[model samples]
Target: MAFPFFGDDKSTIARLLSTLPQTGRIEWIGQRPVRREPLVAVLEAELKTDSHMLGDHARPKAGGKRQVTLIQHESLTAVSSFLGLDAPLDPGRLRRNLAVSGLNLLALKNRQIRIGEEVILDITGECHPCSRMEEVLGPGGYNAMRGQGGLTAHIAQGGIIRVGDVVRVLESATA
Candidate 1:
């Protein structure tokens, strides 16, 4: 899909995107992801930090900037299976820098995803993919994670990220 989006010889992709600005740009922030994790609050209270509207209490300050991660809705669906039938993965649990609906997650790599009035995340690299996904998802939870999940990006500018905020992708050279 991205190949069709950036083909130099074909300007149609750009034109299509220009016409469909709102197709995949806006998504309602339903829930936080990590809040579903049992004992996550015990492990770290950063979830309650004022700087973090979701669960980013322990953002790195010495490294230069904090990291942001975004998980796909498909992955979110996968997460639901891991979560108990009684309790769903909280929207706040995933702690996605930007919870999106229409755009392709893979296509946004290395791009700047703008959230809120001042927050900008410099998608640095894939956040450390962990077995915690399996712990939460259970059973083939490990297999469900075979190449489908979330991503990690660094926060270029730090600010409060909350639910109901709009996200904009500031496309870069690679995007």
Candidate 2:
């Protein structure tokens, strides 16, 4: 279904959505070496086409929509403030594979993006917080992470991605 705003002038909306001039930077990278275990921070990692990140425990089936996960760096501060903490929550605590700053991950939903010099990912959907958030972040943790749960993506093109890499939206989903 097409949104009313995107009915006749869809190109305008598409153009606007695709015109993301600001780029994001990878603030942190974490890998889950085991299920139910805390993610370990890494300086870099390898993305395998149609598969999970190398060294990460998750092994999604080929063409899986959740080959990678990403979170907004700013959301950590928001979640912290929501929980009345004086400092931002650690990226690893949230369990996302990547923490990016300066761009809105939500805006990239259903879009393709290139990271660093090689990796390309397709933002697939929202990565909602699980019950484990309560364990990791105490009471109200789940509620606090409702909208800030970050994004799930699939590797469209594989390569090495590292800390400090630039994230640029390659195109709008419609394109």
Candidate 3:
């Protein structure tokens, strides 16, 4: 869908923002079996429409906007650098459901994206870091994840999503 543009300059920028041709790959998938527990890395998982991942502990109500969470693979590296770590931060430590690579996930806000062949997610908002980061990633973890926390989404369509699945934007939000 086309976003309304008020002026020529704004229209150009909007068009540019809407044209995201780069596809991403799901590099990792993690599911939290219980609240406050470490996420378990998995090769694949089932998404429940308007609910949550089948194996995840989250039981958000139907149509809940934060049913799922994703983090950019590149952001993992950035967070590691911020923490002065020798290795990239583990996706599980960040508490995100999926770790995607090759696309700027921040650019996907308010858009719908398809993962693999069937699962579709409506990008809802930023997944801000919580105090748990301090416990998981060490002292400065919370601050290091400030802007790199990633995204929250609701399942628009349901299906199995696997690691190595291709991720593509399906539609942009209309203004």
Candidate 4:
């Protein structure tokens, strides 16, 4: 069933398709109202509704668009670099729920991501830093975090998410 010019080598096509980015790892996990405290070893991302997640105190309305927040280790590093810092910035200071690695989070907008095995989240949009960034990261902090502030998402399915668990892309965003 292959096209004339394109070879019938199905294996090659399969490999090429599989190479698309679809997986990441949870590097750190934190919750608000408990900033700078020890991170939870395991995160239970229980979603009772589309806009609800366990352990999140913000508790936006039932249809909240930002049920959870996630940040990338790379973005943290970029901010630190922007500020002339010697080391990467601590993710806790950003007040995000999950600090993940190996995923281009900005590219995930409108996509569905599965954390661990069952927890599914819908990428809502870029998470812009509030004025608190200056208080947390010192001078020029707010500007440093401008485009590096990670992303916001809503829980689409309930499940437990643990540090070191794999985060997989379930569905990609359509144009």
Candidate 5:
């Protein structure tokens, strides 16, 4: 859920002037072909196994409660961090957990996004790019991903979230 931020990217000024809520639309969602299993295991098999998703080094990391993951960073730090390299988080990321193109993430407020087939998310808040992003993606990495509104939510339901699955926004939440 990466909604380009206000006063952040090329569209910052336009975003501020625009009244339309930046609704994030899932463009091209990608998953690591070779690392999906390990990534899933790292997430699911954690006996509280806290792994910091960092690239090459474990210093700069994606800030998360359990697994440090990045969402908005253009450097795709989450992917680079895991791959042990410094890179940008562009929509063209090959091993991106989820590659998205359209829709503003902010528009999903109080909404549910069905990522792929099984992951149900109640987007409760915005996902701010953390400092670790800068630490890893260079200096201004955090700034780049911030103004674009990222999404934050609790995994209401968890299941296999594979690539090419349709991601639909439920018009209303289930009571």
Candidate 6:
């Protein structure tokens, strides 16, 4: 017999917690193969351990916290409205490396998220919109992206990430 205040049995708790991982789908993949140029959309990308996503223009730094950036596909509508536009914003215009749907990216901050079966990402911080937003999104674009920008993450466990792959929230933030 177990005490009531001791909480669930270990195995039961493990099963429940594992079932709680949030699920989403990768809608698009983009890479800036050349510096200062546009992000080229692709069907797949390679993620390397402790490095930036392969084929991307951004150089990997030792112990870098930002190896990749992602945006929520649903935020385009909100960003469009913020800019007083009738149409949704394009993901490419945002310059994010990944576009995802069905999960709140912000809620994953400081958490460990997994893509597909092997690729794991540690959400480090927000992917703040840069001044380039003004150049690509027109006047007031910088402000329009405030709070609409997505999440930045580093490669926790590297592997291939493909379009249409599932994005799973494997664990909550430790701190």
Q: Pick the candidate with the highest TM-score.
A: 3
Residue 101 in candidate 1, Cα distance off native in Å = 2.4
The whole-model lDDT of each prediction reads 0.50, 0.93, 0.93, 0.77, 0.44, 0.87
Task: List residue ranges in candidate 6 displaced over 4 A.
Answer: 1-21, 172-175
What digit string (tens of lDDT, one per residue) describes model 1 on residues 32-125?
3444433222211122111333443334443332344566655556566654344445434454444456666666665677666666666555
TM per prediction: 0.59, 0.92, 0.93, 0.79, 0.48, 0.85
lDDT of 2: 0.93
lDDT of 5 by residue, 27-136 (tens): 44332324322222122211111232222122222223322221433335554554455664454332223444345556555567676656666655655656655654
Residue 164, model 1: lDDT of 45
**Worst 10-residue lDDT window, candidate 2:** 1-10
List residue ranges in candidate 3 displaced over 4 A: 1-8, 172-175
lDDT of 3 by residue, 1-175 (tens): 6546545687688787898999999999999999999999999999999899999998999978899999999999999999999999889999999999999999999999999999999999999999988999999999999999999999989999999999999765722
Clashing pairs in 6: none
Candidate 5 worst ten-residue window by lDDT: 40-49
Better of 3 and 6 by TM-score: 3
* TM-score, model 6 to reference: 0.85
Q: Per-residue lDDT of 1-175 in model 4, one digit per residue for the tens?
A: 7664367688877554444476899988876545445334344455555765566567777656788889987888899999999999777777788888998888788778888878888888899988888888898999999988889887777777888889887745422
True-vs-predicted CA distance for residue 13, candidate 1, Å:
10
